[model samples]
Target: MDLKRRMQECDEFFRLPELAHLVPQRRRAALEQLEQTGGYLQTAEEILIGAKLAWRNHARCVGRKHWRSLKLLDARRVRSARDLAEVCWQHLQMATNGGAIQSMITVGPPRQPDGREFHIINSQLIRYAGYRNGDGTVIGDAANIRLTEFATELGWRGAGTPFDILPLLISTPDEPIQWFDIPPELAREVELEHPEFDWFAELGLRWHALPAVSNMNLEVGGMTYPLAPFNGWYLGAEIGARNLSDTNRYNMLPLIAEMMCLDTGSERNLWRDQALVELNRAVLYSFRRAGVYIVDHHTVAKQFCDHVKREEAEGRACPTDWTWINPPISSGLTPTFHRYYDPPDLDIRPNFVRRDFSGDGGI
Candidate 1:
């Protein structure tokens, strides 16, 4: 987009009563630089506010109620792929926070005038490697097949397990892609077990505690921080209902159904539905047992409602995507499923945008 125009829009946003606490001079200086050189650097305060606003403006997120609590780390001064990878590891350590899971975003160096920038290849900081067998079976999270193949091409190898964590891949303009293994301690995972069913633990299911997304670009003011990885605590359904249960991913429903001795011969039996509920219960039970912070879909939907009300009280509309705001399971039972919201606008600045991973070695 036009850099000058976005800066002007951002300048006006800061002038609003809610953001008046931020010094106006920084924006003036940025505007002056843009006018003279056709580019400008965002000050730390601008970056922080922009990141927070971006989260607030993100339509797909149901966790926007905690936008102000996001911790912003300006890593623009980082000079190499290795340094960037190290910062990412540190981000993991900090965000994990011994299972309390702090909300955070790390803004890397902004794109140059010609659009060259660093980017993390992984969609999320932590994801299981998906190994496709010749028999058309996947050993891990099938959703990550592309990334897993890319990592293999880069000489990174996995232990060939259903829950093997993939290495981090960082790409810079002029450097070869670099990969880093997340320190084992920082790759915290919760082993899933049902409180009522002891046999559930035999499934050997687990999931990472953090959900830091690394592949999305952070568009703030006029600059695009391509390596801005951010995360929030996960809603239980994301892991339980979608990740573990989705057919395209681990596809655990059939196995769970068989183990429970449920009649899955027909769709009318609702075996999949019963298995889904038990899997969700196991996820919630396990996280709580492990002392890792997690929220249920019902609770998050209520929080989303509160967020919408707060945004309305400020005389601003809360742009929302009904499809994403609603949970995958029992969506109709939640408050978010019953109401219409302001239509989402893609042009909103200070927002996160999915990065294109269509290039060679890309995910």
Candidate 2:
């Protein structure tokens, strides 16, 4: 993007109506530099606003009800690989907040004028390794095989479990990509167990406490931050319906059906649906009993509808991607499914943009 357009986006974010009360006064020199050279978020208030705006403008996310409450941690001073790893570890702990997850993002240094950017190769802060067998069967999470291979190429050692957090792979301009092991305590996870099914605990399914997506490039005006890892509390369906039940991921629906004694002999039995209910039940039950923050699809869908109403009241279009607004399981049941959403912004500013991970194509 051109520098002038980027500066205007930064200015618009600074002047957003939701943050009207909290907006800080800008300095004369900074304002001059913003117009002439380029804009950069200077104050804590500006940083916070930028991060919040990014979340609010994320068209594909249905969890933007807490966008205004995102905690911004400025880690722009983290220059070395060690410091970057430490900052990420700290971010995990802070976001987890002992089961009461906090909506948070840690901002790394912005993109340089020459287009150099810092990036983490892992898709999420925590994910499992997938080892594919000869006959196209995966031993672990099938969705993670490509990333697992990447980590293995980087000399990472997995624990050979259903769930394993990937190591941090950070790359910058001058330095070759460096991999760092995530601190054990930082990646807190919960073992899946059902309230009714005794065999559920025996399956030994586990998932990370927070889904901190680490790869997206965060743009705040003209400066694009390449290593901003951000997270929201998980939705029950994301864990149960998609992650565990999907064929390309854990592919546990068939196992779950067999365990439940559901008729999976034919497609007419609706076996997948029955199994999904149990899986979702286990996830919701486990998170509640473990005192972790998790939202069910029905409740969050209603909350998202309310968010849309509020945004409409404020004369702001609730731009949303319907495919994402609808949950993986029971698409017809959620409130978000019935209604049409406003078209998303073509160029959403102060947002996280996709980045190229392999062979240094700058964002």
Candidate 3:
């Protein structure tokens, strides 16, 4: 976890405005005392600092320009299944913000001596239920088939649609996975409709307002927090090009092309390309109509370039993942595709690290 280096990072961070009180004494002694007792972020303000740094260090996210504005909720005291469920609901409500999405995170308790921590098994707080039939066909979003199967085994049922929100799955130290159905009022979804095509609304396409990633662990200082669910407003292409059009996901491009009456006989005609544009347009239009905060691919790409320029100006090399930084569609058209980044540092702390979920029978 690079304990010494992170303590030094915290030392410098506390030097920022309104934070000098944290390191009034010798930074070394304060760090040693905190590390010795495993109390890295013992206060709400300390956790807020860590959460902001975590967002800043997220290599795959291109929305670092608002890192300092991330809202952090210190839910470290929440332990039981019921409490976890309520917290998840609250996170959705707060992040959704009634259409004005806000970037936020809820830091759960750190890992225990028994190697267990409170966590949600789903990748996102809002995702479709994937149900697999015996003949290999699937219903709903295929991306979550494994989780959907697991949830079904744990007694969860969905409405059998392309946009059903999966129930919250919570696991404690030594208990079965707890299931909680999120209230419909808390999950604000955008109903996608094309501006030019009236038939598009018949597809009943929809998605949750915010993308709250729930499975990643947060590492700050020397402690490994196994359950830190964080969220940010979506980039439109994430839904149009990847989630809704990926062959293994909703696979909507071909259908949309047919509906648009584009020539599907040959790939040279770029039927898929036309469909992709319409899909992306619909996503942006719907979010805008609902007063939600969603950035288009081109805008976010330019913003990412600006973020890197600012970081480099401050004498820091920006680490990034090219595959994630590049939008799923029209990569060559965006400014972000033209640049190279420093090699990623896999050992960086105060970053979201995926936890291994194998052999977790205790749920």
Best by TM-score: 1
Write the residue-wise lDDT of candidate 2 on 256-330 in tens digits.
889999989998999998889999999999988898999999999999999999999988887798998889988
TM-scores of the candidates in the order shown: 0.96, 0.93, 0.92
Give the Cα error of residue 49 in candidate 3, in Å: 1.0
Off by over 4 Å in 3: 1-21, 24-41, 360-363
lDDT of each: 0.89, 0.82, 0.82
- Tell me, what's the RMSD of every candidate? 1.5, 2.4, 2.6
lDDT of 1 by residue, 98-172 (tens): 999999999888888776788888889999999999999999999999889989988999999999899998889
Please give, for residues 179-297, the per-residue lDDT of candidate 3 as tens digits: 88889998888999988899999989998888999888887655567778889899999999999999999899999999999999999999999999999999999999978889998
lDDT of 1: 0.89
- Which residue window of length 10 is worst by lDDT in model 3? 9-18
Model 1 is weakest, by summed lDDT over 10 consecutive residues, at: 10-19
Q: What is the lDDT for 363 in model 1? A: 59
